[model samples]
Target chain A: MANGSTLLVGIAQGIQRPSALQRMLPSATRRVLNVQLTELEHHGLVSKTIFAELPPRVEYELTDLGRSLLPVIEVMEQWGNTHRTALEQALAGNLAELPN
Target chain B: MANGSTLLVGIAQGIQRPSALQRMLPSATRRVLNVQLTELEHHGLVSKTIFAELPPRVEYELTDLGRSLLPVIEVMEQWGNTHRTALEQALAGNLAELPN
Candidate 1:
């Protein structure tokens, strides 16, 4: 359920429909996606478009501000990939001490 | 508040402490980070380590499964950066029809 906005962005990249998003993510995650989308839309990071039709077709896409975040996201992803092993080790070391 | 896991990862990459995360993000987002960290630890995506001390100290890091996700996160970030303009245009188009 965490990083719902990124998931929404993932959905926008391809998922397209809310129903599809629900199916792709878990139930709790679906709720997170819904909330994130609302916030993203409110922030103008994303926008919803409805085309005229009997059912009223709708789609979500990123906005200018959102686009501006692309570089940052990309850097993060790159960093994640490059440092995966070290990060995992760090996490594992931390987990070893957690109480059951 | 959305994408809290990613934010947490960002924190782990450097933030190191909950307080640092709080200062880096908005208030609502700080709460989300706390929640996401808990879930991440529960799922073994992250682990916490406590050092022995009078006051004690803790740190969070990624796990093996979480490391596996690094490739995915990287791809998403690259995609975001590469497709920034197109995504923005798409989002802009969607926003055009939103009711006030």
Candidate 2:
């Protein structure tokens, strides 16, 4: 996943709790996810709800606009998965036999 | 298109000439397009060819890896077109009534 799309995809896939979201993205530090989540919120893609209960429960849910992104995310994920190997090579400029 | 994908898309749609690619993305200056084309070449997504002819013809073409990105670009463009209004607002953080 690129940009905050991974976090948005995580939120869409029933992982709304912050801790759960963090676990979903093991590579990103908690602080990074927090920052990205904040950006996602600022972008109107997701909404956070805070409860007044003890411990202050908080969860993220996709807004209407955010939900609209799911289809786009779906195709992106599919393409990435399908092209993962070539993509890795492409990013590294490792592929050979191109014209000079 | 995002992250130089517009240029890739332009090339995919048969607009291979540098001048035509610049025309396709009018928002970006010629120099900006050149920079992005360099980046794309660096990333192994595109290849440049120069013809040793009278006018020194040059063109950009997607490598096999780059052509694979077409589906991803298609969906991204679709989503952007569909959400252009909200996305514009979101970028400016001008969204109203987003959770306080």
User: Which model scores highest in lDDT?
Assistant: 2
| Candidate 2 per-residue lDDT over residues A1-100, each given as its tens digit | 3757888888888889999998878888988888888888877899999999999998999988899998888887887798788767766654453466
DockQ of each: 0.10, 0.47
Superposition error at A42 for model 1 (Å) = 13
Show model 1 residue runs off by greater than 4 Å: A1-100, B1-5, B11-14
How does model 1 score on DockQ?
0.10
Clash pairs, model 2 backbone: none
Q: For model 2, what is the error of residue B22's alpha carbon versus the real structure, in angstroms, after optimal superposition? A: 3.2
RMSD of 2: 4.0
TM-score (second chain) of model 1: 0.76
Q: Can you list the residue pairs that collide in candidate 1?
A: A3-B3, A61-B91, A91-B61, A94-B48
Q: Considering only chain A, what is the TM-score of each predicted structure? A: 0.74, 0.83
